[model samples]
Target: MPGFLLNLNSVVICSHGGQAKPTVPNPRVRVMGMPVTTLGPPYVVAGCANPPPPVNVGPCVIGNWVLAALRVKVMGLPVLLQDSQAICVPTGTPLTVVLTQMRVKGM
Candidate 1:
């Protein structure tokens, strides 16, 4: 189980790393059918399926930059902000979040 946890952690890290530097240009992220702009480097929030369309989705970032940018100055990086000011997304729709910036700890 410990090994599984470690692997899972690694999987999460790798996933974040890939998202931090997406090679695909103009990656479209939608929720509940509406388009949204995320705060960070385009991270898909887990388990936010079937969101209302045309919603503003914020991405999770490490203080506006990925851990790669932290260098050695910061002892460790903080987790990305998972929640933001809630916007009214109409029910029964998927929202689209277009990532514009990196989601940092604080807005």
Candidate 2:
């Protein structure tokens, strides 16, 4: 299995807001490497930190370098690291990442 070094702050977790419950610092964060399972939910496994017995919850991270797979999505965006085959990224090129998730509230 391949692995990727990821910044935990860059990953997104879809879940309920803390207004319904007390905030927990650095909740257990996990990820399932992509090409996702056909017709089913993604299978989650340990991605970073020394995980403690797997508790599912909202978004949380202490901002550290953790290992995951390039297939995983970070912050609702694709990591776009590498391919299954060896490919070369052109040097000195400008790249732009466009985020499609926009929110307009509390106007």
Candidate 3:
């Protein structure tokens, strides 16, 4: 199993009058080297401190194998598939990974 190191941050905003409120600083949820299975719905996990991570609400199953797909929220996202076996993303980028759940047909 492979894992990723993520740098995260939490923020809070308060509204007043007719203008938008400022953001309040909170503790960052640094999910360093956490399993991809832990990243899911109801609880969002992303890469950067700027743009939020993409939403993943589905399974990533193919044939009889389950494949994982990571949504990276960054500029010019580049993906490299090594030896047609593994896929990789660069560093200094924020990513939200999703693991596939298996449900074989006629099992």
lDDT of 3 by residue, 1-107 (tens): 23232222212111111111112211222133212121211222222223223542222111110122244322222111110011112112222222222221110
Clashes of 3: 1
Ranking by lDDT: 1, 2, 3
Estimated TM-score for each candidate: 0.17, 0.16, 0.14
Off by over 4 Å in 3: 9-37, 42-107
Best lDDT among the predictions, by candidate number: 1
For 1-107, candidate 1 gives per-residue lDDT tens digits of: 00100000111212222222221112243223323233333333333333233553332322222322222112232222223212212221222222323322232
Model 1 gets an lDDT of 0.25
- Shift of residue 81 alpha carbon in model 2, Å: 6.4
**Candidate whose TM-score is highest:** 1
Model 3 lDDT, residue 21, Cα: 11
TM-score of 2: 0.16
User: Cα lDDT of all candidates, in order?
Assistant: 0.25, 0.22, 0.20
